[model samples]
Target: MSFTLERAQAAEPKILANGMKSFDHFRKLAGIPKLDEFFVDAGELEQLLPGLPLSGDSALDKLSMLADNDYRTYAVGLTRWNTSGGLERKREVEYPPASNKIGYFNGLALVEIWVIDPPVVKASCGHTVVNPLHLALSYSDDKRIFDERVSLELGNMLEELGYEFENRWS
Candidate 1:
């Protein structure tokens, strides 16, 4: 489907609202030291996540596989950190888990399409980290990339996977 700027303007609030955790939270969980493929310290990362991927080229290989094939990057949700929102408090006490799979960097695919061994939950959801590397801040208001590429895809994929989307905007 063709995504338009108006649609993006309308959807921005909802996209930002979907279950955002901190970069530190998912970073520890995913065992990914950094977002871009080039910056990962393999040796240290391996020490951290013993069993999972992230050895040598395996992590990038897996990233390409997940992104190109099954919307794998979507699994590790990348979101804009709402500075005003602050840290996310633990809310599972009230609602059922937002995503069916609540994973902590195990490398197992969290998508419902794949029934992982023992039925593992969601692997990772990308979050907004206010950092120099976050290019979203650079986007001109009229040309916000959130409407076009990764964010839209990730948001839609989450909805499809039964993620209970929350509109913190309202």
Candidate 2:
């Protein structure tokens, strides 16, 4: 579920030299597959397909791609993936010094999640931070329930991780 320091360091050069999409040749490296981050189970895929921002035609096309492959382990033997979490926290120890990233590698973590109505998973890489809440959308009209459930589930998960929040919305 995590990236290996060695394999990640090896792939880092390619992403650094060219953009993140560079080195397609080395895409099938010796590590975890990247598809896990994007694709869900076929059953969950059907339920969440509408949540994705794709046209009707493109969505169908994605199903076509899925039909032609074995997901979850499509290319388990290849394709390396990493969280890319702390790599940006301090690529080099200069300017303002931060130790959160280092502590993240250890078992120490302090989550300060923002309170928002719609559920959004904020992903950060380098200088890019994207909150793709749109992916949580569905065709259902009773969206408030989903929002409440998200808040509850997220709160439960955070609490299970031994995090307690102050001044958080109830």
Candidate 3:
């Protein structure tokens, strides 16, 4: 698929075009690099979620396998802080009970893809804090969507921390 998201649509349609227009627009504004890969075929997806019974041995088994794979593939970053003499060093923590809930909204197919390393706050010194870094990858066409989503999320986070707009933007 070309996935081009150029000309704006006359009106929001019931179905979201898989074209890359909206994604490109978001990427340009976020200053993110183009994605390297975006499409995944059924076989590839199967590799990640194996144990599918041919046609009725046990559909539940296949579902369990898929769910397990989903959880393993998507992870969100977690962090914890420690107090020290005048200064603090941040530590990257593991995901808590309910982490990694990144979802894709395609109008018809809305699925929550597992998050691999959700960002987490590591430490704070009442002035500055550290957050775990998470790098997301995708195909060039969808880079903009990922960029916009991350930018908006990060912006809100920094704002909540009371960080100055200039510093946060920088």
Candidate 4:
């Protein structure tokens, strides 16, 4: 389905309300030290949630399995760009040549779960410290396949815990 920011924003509150406690449970299981580190390994998720139903390399396949079991899924596609040259340059070359792929995922995958009372704090020095309650999964260079696996496993766990699951690409 085509993703709309308005729809996503409207859905956020419900997702957060339903998934907050469960999200915290998974975060503790993953041993995440910070909030922004939303992604976890499939192995870790499996270890934490032994009864999850989906597995393997393909995100689509896993998502299909979840749908069969009556879970809602959404996919969002994301593109990363080099913005070191500032806003004007960013607009000028939105999609740079392939040579500039370093430090960027031309098509990165992200799975986000909403949460309430995100653990974010602003320090006296004015720096924001984020300890998010939401969940997001992404593929890293070293473990390219794990992102899909983790996202699927997370969905299974959330369902088991009595929350609706939505998968987004962005």
Candidate 5:
């Protein structure tokens, strides 16, 4: 189905609900005994709820808006960095640069959805680099186990939404 603002708005509630459920599944699969300790200050199940509405004309905008709305500190700057594997890396990036010989679309937002306990799945907004908008999900850990578990959880959530999603790992 075509992605429209109205459609997005309609899907928001279910999407958020599933997103949180996906997180819980991730925690269980990851063998995280305590959700409170695993998910920063928020207690188990509390952190996932009442996700803020992300505002923007584009899907990336909405995602970023939702991320920002959920975490105020991260939104002050257009980009933020988090430590992963002992190195600090920018959490967001522009999709296409002018130097590329192949035509690639821009205005896409590549966001890393951060959770205290890392999930296995990597989420992306578009099918390819040429796609205009994207929201890619990555975790702090680089373990294959995490990636696999997260991918499964994410796949299940997307499936519940009836959204076409690709599992890059398989």
Candidate 6:
């Protein structure tokens, strides 16, 4: 999971505007869903319909780091979901600018996962410098220990993260 915060310019509005454009540019390049960023507030986590571990700090950190700097923070957690039984696939990228590249792609990965009595999953797709399909499939496989609901919900949640998705089931 990742969180971002942005300190918008209170001074010249142009700075804010430039900042916004850069933010959007990176957001688009990173393949983050604009909607997810909008609806999910860090403060609203405690009040969400379902009890979730997600918080506003994660979201804030994501937004804050979009500027010409590295300011994003992330956390990792694990949960279980039903699977067809198989080896989960994984990949590694070896290159320079790992942080920024990772940051760019990581910022776009908007997933709302839960460590509830029963876990939940949702996945979404989008365009970016990186292949969202790869990211989505990795997530699906990672959480395969859960049920279809988790997968389905994961898809929706991912879409909320800023990816354009088509429901093959629907």
TM-score for each predicted model, relative to the true structure = 0.23, 0.17, 0.21, 0.21, 0.22, 0.19
Across 8-93, the per-residue lDDT of candidate 3 in tens digits comes to: 23323222243212322332333321122122233433444332111110111122221121222212111110111111212221
Ten contiguous residues with the weakest lDDT in model 4: 84-93
lDDT of each: 0.25, 0.25, 0.24, 0.29, 0.26, 0.27
Best by lDDT: 4
Clashing pairs in 4: 35-132, 74-167, 76-169
lDDT of 6 by residue, 12-70 (tens): 22213212223222322333211112122223222332233222223222222212223
**In candidate 5, residue 140 scores what lDDT?**
23
Total clashing residue pairs per candidate?
A: 8, 0, 16, 3, 8, 30
State the TM-score for model 6: 0.19
Residue lDDT tens for model 2, 1-170: 33232463366443333133222222223232221112223343334222322311122123222121122211111111122121112122111224435332232111111112222232332211112211111111122233344333333333343332221233
- The residue-by-residue lDDT of candidate 5 on 1-170, one tens digit each, is 12132333334232233233333233223332111111122221123322212211122222222221132211101121132221222232222222434322222222223232221222264211111111122222232133454444434434444432332243
- Report the C-alpha lDDT of model 4 over 57-89, residue by residue, as the tens digit: 222333334221122111111221111111111
Runs in model 1 deviating more than 4 A are 1-38, 52-147, 161-170
Ten-residue region with minimum lDDT total, candidate 2: 72-81
Measured on C-alpha atoms, candidate 6 has an lDDT of: 0.27
lDDT at 27, model 6: 27
Cα-based lDDT at residue 28, candidate 2: 29
Candidate whose TM-score is highest: 1
Backbone clash tally for model 6?
A: 30
| TM-score-based ranking | 1, 5, 4, 3, 6, 2
lDDT head-to-head 1 vs 6, winner? 6
- TM-score of candidate 5 against the unseen true structure: 0.22
By summed lDDT, the worst window of 10 consecutive residues in model 1 runs over 111-120
